[model samples]
Target: MSIQEKRNSDFFLRPRFSIDLKENPEELLERITTYLKSDACIYRSNVADKHVFIDIPVRKSHFWSPQLHFEIVKVDKNSSTLKGLFGPKPQVWTLFMFVHFVVATLFLGVGVFAYVQYRLGESLVFPIAILVALPLIWLLLYFLGSIGKETGKNQMKELHNLLITIIEQ
Candidate 1:
């Protein structure tokens, strides 16, 4: 079935809230968690400098079609309002950057090595090696990066959930 059709067939409800960031992150999180636990809301966020866009689910179902999604609900518009809520956690970003750097270094090093080997009287072997390996290396890197991003997204979601739980009590 088409995405829209699938969505229409499934249960879909958007959570109701009037979010304002003037309150502290902890307070806001507490309120959100209270709402979530009471109503079993699922949520996602698109964080930005001046605003955070949140999507809260109001349906009661194990599964929802991808097309059955809610638009972003703006929470905050002032950067200062989100100081504690928006900035990257140092450890997470550090690890991510480290992994990215390592992957890039490995790719460049292998590419250069293959090129040098070809130049050192390996005949056309090195060129063929490079042709085969470079694309594969790049593709692998791309996939790995994508996986990392997905992982990060999952982690963020979990963290948000955890924060909600902590604030609820």
Candidate 2:
């Protein structure tokens, strides 16, 4: 019943964790499949090979709903390990990453142009403003991710509890 928390970077919106289990890998997968398929489950789930994905029901979801993804790794013949992650939906993750990439690219491009303007003795106001603003925007993105994680905190706990229950059984 020991679940150890691994502190990945403090800003990581997607949290990764692992649990040691005494059951075999196949048995763990089978248990997740069986539980997800049974009537007692309130969540939606997908099982493929050694991986399992759990989602909140659509009727009770929001723009920041969390998803649980886990993989069972074989640890010798008599035991297995369950590595799990809690994150936003793939599309949302992609969107955030794309925005970050664009912001970074713009920051670089704007910085170069601003430097050129400075060297040319032209107006430095606009590019300097942009340079300052880009970092603020980046910081905003980080805070937004933190806010989103906080928004989905309860669901994260629910998903985690469900995984613990499955693994403990």
Candidate 3:
């Protein structure tokens, strides 16, 4: 958190935050870059222009390790805002989305097949079982994602703290 930090309680998959600071945006970005380069900095980070990417070291990271991506935007000559997102590594996110897509497709396919079987007076046991099961699987995925977020919550906090430190300087 900086002078003012906005917490987005509605975003689930990727928590969002923004901080307002009374400092020049470009100078703030450069200061962040220099701060992240110090020997004492523990997080692995990349600073390019007004954007910063911060992550836990790979050896200490898990599939669900959260990463921070943020940008600085000038609001006035003497003030700027830092907007950030905390999310799963891009690969994990892509895989999660892909799995959800597959589950949805399977649900639709099975529903159509069940309708056809019902029309033909065939037993609804198997298709209905599958249709019932897909939703449960989706729910499981949702819970798993929430669990992952909880698992990485501390690391996300650490990353945010680092940003706050850089911004304060």
Clashes of each: 0, 0, 0
Please give the ranking of all candidate structures by TM-score, highest first, separated by commas: 2, 3, 1
Report the error of model 2 at residue 135, Å: 0.6
The global C-alpha lDDT for each of the candidates, from Candidate 1 onward, is 0.41, 0.87, 0.89
Residues 36-118, model 3: lDDT tens digits: 88897878898777888999987889988999999998999989988999999989999999999999999999999999999
Q: How does residue 49 of candidate 1 score in lDDT?
A: 35
How accurate locally is residue 99 in candidate 1, as Cα lDDT from 0 to 100? 66
State the lDDT of candidate 1 residue by residue for 5-34, as single tens digits: 011211112112222234455455445445
lDDT score at residue 46, model 2, on the 0-100 scale: 92
Instruction: Return whichever of 2 and 3 wins on TM-score.
Output: 2
For candidate 2, report its TM-score.
0.92
User: Which of 1 and 3 is ahead in lDDT?
Assistant: 3
Q: Give lDDT for model 2.
A: 0.87
**Which regions in candidate 2 have their CA more than 4 angstroms from the true location?**
1-11
